[model samples]
Target: MSHTATPPPAMPPKLAEIVDEFASAPRDVVLEMLLEYSDAVPPLPETMTDRAGMEQVPECQTAFFLRVEVAADRTVTTWFDCPPEAPTTRAFAGILAEGLTGAGADQVLAVPDDLYQRMGLAQAISPLRVRGGTAILARLKRQVREQIG
Candidate 1:
């Protein structure tokens, strides 16, 4: 007798609610939901800047690097994880550019809780976190490219 493989469990309903909302929603709707989810997911680093100038940056500031492994039924699971970090104007822009071009993400964003919490908005973040986010983003981008290719 032949046996079929059983699939993994789907994402939790609560988490699915959040991910599906973003996955299927319009850009503005996704952004709004992401903000709400980010807020509730704290002890988040509130130290990130509140400056309106930061808005000039692209949407990539909020995207977390992920390796999404989709099942036959289209359920998604992360095959790999990278910590949240996006620091510096130049590095942030590069992340958006590379992530978009490489990952096919029209927009890329990040959650810099670790960096922001450590640096706080008043005090500048340590050079380490700043550099770390850049490095991690670069590494994740490369990984995505290699896998896709």
Candidate 2:
């Protein structure tokens, strides 16, 4: 018998592009791209300097906090706090921040929960790190739902 793998659900355009890139990239290139994204993680705005309002994702091996804001128009913006030492976690945050920010709440919520799996990150990074990324997506989506309600 022969079987075919099912494609992942459609994602937001930017995120889908990122996933497609990683899915086809060599392992070394994946790591390099992740590092590039790590550097791309945006700085927290002045109002979020305290980070008291952010939620922590204990699933991450490092200390990581994130906040998701949905504008009155239902556009989403994400902020993340992770030590520079934790490049992988920072890369995950950067991916979400860049891909999901400016997306509609419905679009953000429609994102598949197994986003990291689709990116093929486990082939380049540890499963634990991939798990952390998954948790980050979950938290971001939860916040989006809360904001919309």
How well does each candidate superpose onto the true structure, as a TM-score? Answer: 0.28, 0.90
Clashing pairs in 1: 47-121, 60-108, 60-109, 61-109, 61-110, 62-109, 62-110, 63-109, 63-110
Q: lDDT for model 1, please.
A: 0.33
- The digit string of per-residue lDDT tens for model 1 on 1-149 reads 99898754332334333334444555445334333332222121233323311112122344433333333443322222222342243333332232233222111222222322222211333455445445444453344334444
Q: Pick by TM-score: which candidate is best? A: 2
* Model 1 lDDT at residue 128: 50
Candidate 2 minimal-lDDT segment of 10 residues: 6-15
Local accuracy of candidate 2 as per-residue lDDT tens digits, 3-76: 89876434578988888898898777889998889987898889888896999999999999999889989888
